[model samples]
Target chain A: MFVIYCPYCEEHREEEEFHASGQAHLARPLDPDNCTDKEWGDFLYFRKNPRGLHQELWQHTAGCRKFFNITRDTVSYKILETYKVGESPKVNLEDASHG
Target chain B: MDTVNVSNQYATNSVTERAEFGDSNTPVIASALEHANMKSLAVKTATGLGVTLVELPVTGMLVLRARDDKPALAAALKSSLQLDLPNVLASNVVVDNGKSYCARWIAPDEWLLSCPLQDAFEIEQNIRTAAGASSIAIVNVSGGFTTIMLSGNNANDVLKKSVTYDVHPSHFTVGKVVNTVFSKAQVTMRCLDTNHYEFIVRRSFADYVWLWLQVASAEYGISIEIE
Candidate 1:
């Protein structure tokens, strides 16, 4: 079982306590009323299923009940880091391939 | 013969007639384990029991939520409850005027405060008045949850088998609390002392947890304590 670390709780908890929400850092259109249908549809329905390093939003459902971002390697299923919302991830796709 | 008479009396009262709509002055209150038959289960074991489980009497509980202005919130709590907001994953307990008050950090912006049941309403009003104009939420959740004390020689073993979270003394020291799953049920677990733990569980799940505890502590002899 994966022991995921919750940034808010500042401790590693069992994976059963967490739930993956989706891809993180999705920006809503500034002017939704004037935005094209494609933009709105993309924001609502689309999600990236990246193979390598990916950034995803996760909620510590059983712990603090707070949502945070997790940078993980999808292929290796290894969590690189976990950070709170509105914070930038330290590990990028390029950084994963080299190290 | 006594059981038959009791069943007959219960059958005589229709479902609607059995309901008591008491006035505010004499409002009736019942604990979540009212029907658990805990009193009958309070056993006096001959051998040393490994786990002792007790359902603490109903107490007042409040959920305080504030996104920002923590200092203002802390000040209000201090003024009203004579308690301090605990740090993350920590809990603080204090006794004021013979009434014990506890504040447990539930999240970054949420904390659970509990006190004597009789003083809940007054405490809520005091905190609200103290936090006038501040963006904070104080909800009276006393009836929504219940506290269970699990302690004994093998309490840690029972916890380790029930929850996925680490319950080792080194990792879960005294005063530390965590919201985690216990046998598919959600519970807020707090370490009171060595091999002593408290669980704040939802009222609806009280029966489930009570039964689960019995089964989990079966191998290690379980005893019930009535409050």
Candidate 2:
């Protein structure tokens, strides 16, 4: 069980209160009508299954009921940093591996 | 402390409006625990015990939610009820303003406020008036949930077995509230004082929570105080 720190609630809560909403920071095409079929398919179905480090979108389902991002190590399950939505992650694959 | 009885505020309001929900004074409302029929079970459990369990006589409970503009509504609630929104989890609660109405933090943007049953409607209207066009939601959930108090020497032990959250005195204290998993269910817990903990569970989960507590506390003791 992982303990996640909610940036908004400012506390480390049990992971049971949270839900992983999939990859974070994925930008949508500016003009969806002009996008090729492949581009739309990629946006809808494509996601990174990283090995060492991963950035994930998580929602605190039980506690604060807010969405945030988590920079975690997939292999070790160590959370490097948790930031709110629209905010940047302090740790990513580059510096996250060392962390 | 959240001062001012939230119900009393409704009594003096000059709005002169009928309750949106039925007038609570004569409504035949039944709590979720009504399915469990705890009254007789409580009588049988209280024979000779150390710790005591009581279904607290709570009148009305409102789930208050606020979004982007939280402080505006919080300030309105504070002025109308004299209770500031608890800024942190498990450290501050506007419980027992010495007038029966109490409030607890459920989430950063959500709070559970309980007051007299007869005045829930008028109070809801009063809060809406106080909020004045702010984006907020006040939901009356009195029949949908209930409060239970567990007190005595082994109360903490029973809690430890039932909830995943740490119940150690060092971590949990008076006026602190937490939303955590209780076995397979969810509950909002508050520490009222030493060896005394309060639980706010949905009516649908009330029987499950009660049964879980019954089995967990059976090893130590079971005492029930029906309100």
Candidate 3:
């Protein structure tokens, strides 16, 4: 199991303390009431299943109980970085794809 | 006091009389392990005792939380408990004589303060008063948790088998506290000395944690002491 750093707790804790909540940085439509059913469904259900670097939303369930984003390599299972909610990941898929 | 009803109940039941009136009527205080009755089990299994386990008496615990750091709040806590809020996770403290509190860091904006059970209510009241108009929350959670101290030469060995965190002195030094997984439950643990560590386990899971400890310490030998 991967040990994830909790941005709030400032400690690297075991994966049991965390729950991966899927893709991160998916902003909702400005006016959801005006969106078509298909648009809403796409926003609600679709997620990126990247092979390399992936941005994920995770909650430190057993520790701080704070939600944060992590840039992890799905293949290697290496966590490049973890940032708090409302913060952006410094490591991106584009950089991993190119560099 | 429900003056009329209380008096009526007092007269009707001797149990109620003992519970309600007179200083001679001392209340029976039950520890988290009241049901387990660990003393009998420990007496049966007493051995060389490489790991020492002690369940501290019911302690007063308070959880303090605030989104933002405020100087006024810090000063207020200092004035009330003579404890400096451990802003850093590595600096949590356990003071008995001079300060009478063990301030543990729970999260970025949260802290757990432990004192004598009798002092919990007063400390909670003091923290609320100190917080004033600030957006802060202080809660009395004494009844919800209990403390267990793990010490002796093989204490670290037993901890390694039980937890994922690196308990090596090089990594987790004295005064550091962390909320992490312990067996199947989460415990707020702090290192008092190299071989000594304290765990704050929730009441419901106290028995489970103790059971885990007993099994883990089997190879190292173990002993139990009640407070």
Best by DockQ: 1
Instruction: Choose 1 or 3, whichever is better by TM-score.
Output: 1
Give the per-residue lDDT digits (tens) of candidate 2, residues B81-120.
7777776674333445455667777777788888777667
Candidate 3 C-alpha error for residue B68, in Å: 2.0
Best by TM-score: 1
Task: Give residue A97's error in model 3 in angstroms.
Answer: 1.7
Q: What is each predicted model's overall lDDT from 0 to 1?
A: 0.86, 0.78, 0.80
DockQ score, prediction 3? 0.67
- Candidate 1 per-residue lDDT over residues A4-88, each given as its tens digit: 9899999999999999998999999999999999999999999889888889999999889999999988899999999999888
Model 1 lDDT tens row, B1-227: 11111121112334324446422322234888999777767855433589999999888898998888787789999998778999999999999778899999999999999998767777777777787777888887888899999999999999999999888899999999999999999999999999999999999999999899889988899888888
Candidate 2 Cα outliers beyond 4 Å, as residue runs: A95-99, B1-24, B90-98
Clashing pairs in 2: B90-B176, B90-B177
TM-score of each: 0.90, 0.86, 0.87
* DockQ rank order: 1, 2, 3
